[model samples]
Target: MGTKTPTEADILRPIKNTSTTYLALVAIAGLAFVLFLIGWSYQLAEGMIVTGLSDWGSGGGVTWGVYIGAFIWWVGIAHGGIILSAAVRLLGMDRYMPVARLAEMLTIAGLSAAGFYIVVHLGRPDRMVTSVVGHYHITVHASPLVWDVTVITAYFVLTATYLGLTLRYDVTRLRDQLPDRFEPIYKGLTIGYTEREDAIVQRMVWWLALAIIIMAPLLLHGGVIPWLFAVLPTYPTWYGGVQGPQFLTIALTSAISGVILLSFAFRRGYDWDHIITDDVFRGLLLWLGFFCLLFLWLQLQQNVTGLFKPPVDVGHAAEGRLGHPVYLTAMSLVFLVLSYIFAQAIRPALFTKKRAAVAALMVLTATLLEKILFVVEGFFHPTFDIYGATPGTYFPSWIEIASITGTVGMVSLFFLTVAKVVPVVELHAIEHLQGDDHE
Candidate 1:
């Protein structure tokens, strides 16, 4: 018998059916998030001192630590995720169509997680309102914090609008087949829908995709986020023009890796082999390799300039990074993944979905470590020696550590919940595949 064809029913399986494994995943994710909340609450009660983060100078420590690092990591993932989706649409990369919506959704989850990190790192939640919102007019020009908040909020709105418009089309066409329990959501999504609006919506989406693509390198990852650190002359490790491209490459690599892992999970859990296809995985892996190469190249550029015939401060920052085991491990992981990708490209038989997923995992881990070290070391080796000695050692307290797990759990739950409410895979993808089958 020939292989079976996928239909809308396949896309709607999670919405209509329940599984033991699904429930188990939900339980685990929920528990992790709850634990994070508990840790956060304890921090709230005991104060920011519990996080082990301290002021610089006389305090003999860095104010920013894992929280800021993780914040940047999450922002990169979010920015890159949307860019991936936008590229698929604007560039007409049909092979990646199946994963486009997944990337868009990842943007939403990632931005949400990043936003939460800001709130968590603020020490007091009210500071967000008082320090950011209340003082926005005065600080807007001077504070990178305000710039960071403004850009993130703007991008979040853009991504949400883009996702919402696409969802309207999907929800309208699949309304009858969708669960009535979610009818209100579907109705709200398609409130002003009509078949006559299809072409117009497509055009709107196209324009939006174009906008996202244009803004990515200029405004999102490559711009504001890296600029937050890059313009600061006090931090030798972070202050440089190269940060723009370096941050963009890392964002793309991390985001692509995230999409690969999510795609693999859904493909396995929903038996969506025909829908997602191994070909898609191969293409994604190739893209991952491309970005990883850029990421490493940028690192080399930074290291060489800082190490060879460099000023005193630059040499110290470079030496500190080169001497760190964490930095070495991160670089090694990316190199290994890159090598595997190249080897697989030469000999297709070497490629396997499991291996691809593993490669993605390694890249994600590598990027996270690289980003954390970037933030920590920037503060660790600043030009000014206000402390008059080495700043006291720093490590993330248990609460700080728990925040990572908690944010991850939060993202997991977002996927789990959203999957149940709507088709994670786009309806157009199914129709396109069906058309190919018919031909």
Candidate 2:
């Protein structure tokens, strides 16, 4: 009767196959264990060197392959959460509350996934502190990744605090009536009566807008789009006028797209179609379409200039870190544009649920490919005698896999655990969503 809000029935209640959120949370805990085991095994059996990354002949050592891929993957995921929270809070949409918790939860999970193992991925794995603060000083102009890490850490703390506050609020609502075992927990969280309606509204707005402003550049910083250009044998692309911003665009596109996909998925899980409806998704798709066209134009402009450069003289372009013919021909340009059209355009206004899901999946797949090609494929530059040779292939060690699994699992668990106690969707918020759906 009360819109899936965690009622006494959640504990006193029995339902089919348990809550999806509960199962997901257990899965998360399992992943966390796997991650710990992986790290432990790596430390015991092979030692640090087995990580496959080393300060070899390359100028610096950083783990590529799965580590980098997962980092980007999780960052994209976190971006979705942050963007969603911003949307709801900034717009004052009540309907978004259900999935808003998930957004925040996923942000905590995905970011944690990336941050935890990056150190393991480091070549000089032990001196991580020295690298961040000492050797690799944070400079706004020099390297955005440094700032990226800093911003991400700060962002994570805020997300955690916000989510915790929300759960605590729910706990206080039920503490007296809750089982005696759980009563103290809620009491501990109250921290002297607070969380007035005005306070919640003001805080949410401030956090939503402020975070959006911070996140745009933060996404770019973590994206390392310019550095990927450095992977070009020539330094030109890295130094190019457009590459940095392009990377930022990619991050923004990927982030918002993720938000749409996740929103739809969660809605489907609960049969919220009456509330969420296709219209919300349609609006999101149109926005994605706009970004696609913008990105396509950028690619068209940059490539056209490259093609027109004189053949013999353009040899210097290689030295300037411009993309080689091989890299350029790779699928990013084609796939990036196509993914947008297929995912955002026809599918939204026309397709059935099944068809839309497939399209969403395609968007995710193509998006990952684009980021990977931009990161790994672009970063693959041979040195000295290895000149003109293709880049080496690398795989993620088990530790990395476990770490990622742990990240995903932990987040899933957090959602489930929270769902058992807190309200996952806003009953009041559902009215906001009704505008788009047919009753």
Candidate 3:
């Protein structure tokens, strides 16, 4: 028999067939969710005392722990999804069409996890709900916290709508091939589908991509998030204009890393090596290398400038970061990985998907550590340093650790569930690219 061409049905196989591995993963995620609930409940019942955070006024201590660190990490990861999607859509990078929807979906999932962290960070979630809902204008306008919430909410809605709109075409195109059980979902997603709607979605998505590309870098990551840290002159390390670009760079790096891992999973799981392609990974890895360089350079800008003159507070903070073994080790590891990735870029023969994945993974770990250090150290050596308080010690409580675990589970669960309902790969993009190939 001639080589069988992969069809829509072939792409939909994951949704139709539930492998044992999938069930096991879902079950484990469910357990983590339960543990997360337990952790949050403990915080609610006991109080903030249960966490490693301490009141700053009484002297010194890390007010934010791993939870906030994880919060920043999750939000940063969310940035990549829409960015990758927007880039592909706006730039007409058809080579990446297969992974665009995956990137968008990852953005939605990452935002969900980030949002969940916000709720978990609140000792009393119900009060925050009432407070925000009841006094939206007063609170939202007045506080950076509220601004973060507002922008994140807006970004989530925009990304979700962007995903939903584009989804209409794919779901409608593959409707007949999908299992009957998914008919209702297909109906809901593709309500009022028409050939004209195709052009309409493309136009809308193009504008949406443009808007997100502008808003995400300027408003969300670079704008509000960095302001949250940079505005506090009390913290020498954080209080600077550099915060915006720094946060944006790390967010892109982590987000690209996330996309790499997700793409690898689907490509391997669904036998999509041809569609996903080595070229896709190669292109993404190059971008990853760029961000990695940017991340390191930004760190240099922040550190070298501070160390050049070395004011008391700046010198103190620098000593804390540079002198610490963990910080040194993480930075060294990131340098090594960045070097390897650059080498691969220079010598294409040196590049392999496995090495790219490994580099991405290391970057994720290194960045996560860097974020935690940034948060904890800023508080550890406050600009005021009022209480004669020394930089405080912090080890995440069990609750915090469990919550992080739960957030990871939540992201995975979100992707896995959505994959079953919709095609993980974009069908229309596939048709377009396949047609071009045939021609």
Candidate 4:
């Protein structure tokens, strides 16, 4: 008659069990990813001209389009995901412990998607090695593209190390119950593990969390990614001081939205109602709302400055953004989601996980649209009028469109594969819950 207590077995369910639904999900995700590969291969054989992108002036169109916008969007999600996880650890936010590892895993998947975008956008993938890696020393000083690559690599390494260290503790304790098929991975993870090192690893993780929190504003989304666009004075739509905070807020909102969607999926699939509770969803929604408010405020600041008796070029860019249907739709979606969040805050009875999930989906869709518009509109109204009377138009080609589905499928597959290898829910979370019950 009483509520059941959660145990390690609950955390390990993904590793120990498989169902028809799970297999079906794997098949669907795999098929989507394969379709993306087919698209990419065609593009590679045909060339960048196969997609919607084209050079400025002569081509009368934008060189960067959905690919670059999606790249920035994915980076924002990755940067914000790590920040959320770091905050949970550094601030001792025990209530969110259940989803901390989920956030970290999201960071890994997001960065991979972002990196993939860079390679896809390059046309010739080998240029990544020759232009970026081979010339890092020279490019690091002058190239924002190189800076973007550098920071992403650094963040990925840090997050991977942070994840590996935590897994050592869990794998060691649960080795007996774990599948022998993954014994090699377990051995490598716990190669030098000992109970005495637990305290040391905790200290190291704490410092890593602190480092991540600090680097976010200085080196990640708030810094390098926006700087890529912000420093380009030729592009009136992107040039300004407002970009840093604007990008940061959008990153946080987008990342929180992603976490909400992911948490909902795992909770439903694993029946983790008790672990990732309704209360956790409520808290996450509130945080998402807060960031959404900041995101809108930043947009207002940019619009006000641009629309009010500004330079001709700046005003033209502002007009383009305000007049765009996609931009209006994106802003409206955010406003609606924010309104629902505010209403729920007043009447807690209004909240439901399904509604929250829907809101998250809206936010994700809005952010993606906003980002793509930001990139396109910047090109549409550049300061230099090299095109003269010629007008530029753009739309995502089928290959470009399939890239999104492919990347989403890839991330989903990453989660599915990782779940079968290790517990997606942290063992520490279960231990913490049990400790609270004892108290």
Candidate 5:
């Protein structure tokens, strides 16, 4: 890391003109806060009904409705960052070393947004303190919501800690240029700057990275997803054996694609076309293709097994999509097939053109649509809510939407603010080691 720290200007150079993206996102966050205010005001002035949540029958109702969805969505997005950065660190993937810093930062930003969104969802967002520290007299069952909060908080703290330590390693590179007075702060940052050797640094990196990977499945598929099973019956697309693992895979996939996209954009923006070459992204596209294929396979198996096996009756209508699984219907099938074709085959072909990029983009977009189908058709829709919703009829209001938007925006805000403060790229980590550090 010595003398190799990429400056703030270096990182920001690429996204400079694109401030508009962050701006719009920030505005949305502001609007969400206002919506939270309005929703709370309405609740206070007109009572709980104004904001939607009462005894809520026996179910968790609108309060946790979109909150659940939003939490999972953002968390899913954030998980990708962690796996790519921290997980890759442990896996000892040297190619990924460059973007580890950026990925870790992005993971923190996304998780922050998710946390804020959960905070806003609390109808009693104000009572979050009690929610965490407060006691529940009733015997508390293991709620997925509790797990989501707990994991997000722990991941956030852990990732932030690692990011801080790594960033210090980064700043150490610039030690010579800095004044003598700043040495102590730098020394403090590196925890006495003693863990600088490759042996010690690599060991520490291994621990953090391993902890994240082993716990990731629990935090997500275990924490956020089981609630769906508890709520939706065992037959739907969202609740079957595959959905949880599928979510984790897609998160990893999206994180991969997103990281690749950012790298390309960052390179183009910073004019680092030499260092950030197409080779970097070409490898990613191939890996992404593999992920796309696996996800498509998973989706096919879930839909086919559910569709062909049996159907449940929800009154007169076709209750579960098990009858046909219309959500992933024909369009989904076609896209999934094409995505796999392009991703698994064409994208990795030894041909050169814009084709790989185009194909990768297609696969990523289609995968996102796939995710929407997974969470929405079954989880968001009330018809699939015997175990989850009540008698069933869910229509989330403006507050939920705005609040969610704000939560996401706040995440973007976190990234923006943090980027402003810290070096986005890990210069030291990016150093091409001539010796064993190369690993």
Candidate 6:
């Protein structure tokens, strides 16, 4: 007999199944999250001194360190995740349907992590409510930080609402088989939901997807986040117009890499090889290579132009940006990964699941390191150096390290917990696949 077509039960197995392995993973994640909270409490007690972060050009210290770097990394991942989902919906790319919700879940987790970093960076978390949220007088034009908060908040809500609205359709369809305990939740989700309601939902979701696709590349990363750095004429490296596109390209690269990793983990745990097939990996890898190339090109654009006839500040900054050992290593890794990806594309036999996964990991690491370097270097060497030409030193403190680990753990815990309740893979998408298979 030919391979059996997977049914709804197969997709829902993760929801019903219980295993010691699953519990162990959840326990680990919970522990990490708790540990992170403890670290934060310590930081709160001792004050921001416990962190390497300090005022810019003051006390020979750079104001942004791991916290701001992490913020950028997570936000990049969040931007990329939702963009993937939006593209899938808008383009009718059913080939990627199996991974859509997974990507969407990643967006929520990434955004949450980003928000957590912002809170941790604030040092006085209460002031977020008192200073920003409480005061209505702050205009978007007032500060780049305020602009970042505004757009990030908006993006989070829009993505969360998009996820919630889409889940209603699945909840309604699976209402009968879903656990009785979840009946109330399902009812709340499916209230007034009918088969005919899907048409209305699809239309609404399509428009929302359109809006996000526009907002992500144009407004979020390309607009506000980059503006925070790019608009500063004092920061020679960051003052250029290229930061927006550079950030967006790297964001897409990191986002694709994250999705690939999540897809691999879920596939291994749930035995989803058939649904999340080799083609999915191949397609995503191609996109990763495309972004990798764009990122490399942009790096060259920034470096080459900055090096030529550069002002004193730009020349000084370029030396650190282009000549740093870590930066050089990351750029080399990008080139190797991109070359490997292209080689595999030309000769299909060279490609393997493991190879693609490794390439994705390389890209994620390189992008993250690059982002951290950008933040630290930009702060260290300002346009008007108060500390002469020498930049301050920064290494993440234990508190910062713990917070990073804890945020990662929280993201894992979220997905693990959600998998037990909602089907991580979409049933409706699978139904469509089945129909096409039969035809």
Against the reference, the lDDT scores of all candidates come to 0.91, 0.54, 0.83, 0.91, 0.58, 0.86
Model 1 C-alpha lDDT per residue in residues 344-383, reported as the tens digit of each score? 9999999999999999999989998998899889888888
lDDT (Cα, tens digit) per residue for candidate 4, span 253-289: 9999999999999989988998898889999999999
Write the residue-wise lDDT of candidate 3 on 1-439 in tens digits. 1133446766787788888888998999889988888888888899988885765556445778787788888889898778988999999888788889888988888888888877877777886768777788799777888899989999999998999998898887777777788788889988888988788788999999999999986888888988889898878878899989989988998898889988888877777776777898988888888888888888888779777877888777877777777677667767887898778878889988788788888988888888887888788776677777466677778888888788888888888898888888888767865676676
Model 3 residue pairs with clashes:
234-383
Greater-lDDT candidate between 1 and 5: 1
TM-score of 6: 0.96
- Looking at model 6, residue 353 earns an lDDT score of 81
Query: Tens digits of per-residue lDDT for model 2 on 201-271?
Result: 45765675576656555443334534444334443333355665555555545555555655665555555
Ranking by lDDT: 4, 1, 6, 3, 5, 2
TM-score of each: 0.98, 0.71, 0.95, 0.98, 0.73, 0.96
Find the 10 residues in a row with the least total lDDT in model 6.
1-10
TM-score head-to-head 1 vs 5, winner: 1
Which parts of model 4 have CA positions greater than 4 angstroms off? none
lDDT of 6 at 108: 92
Stronger candidate by TM-score (3 vs 6): 6
lDDT of 4 at 278: 88
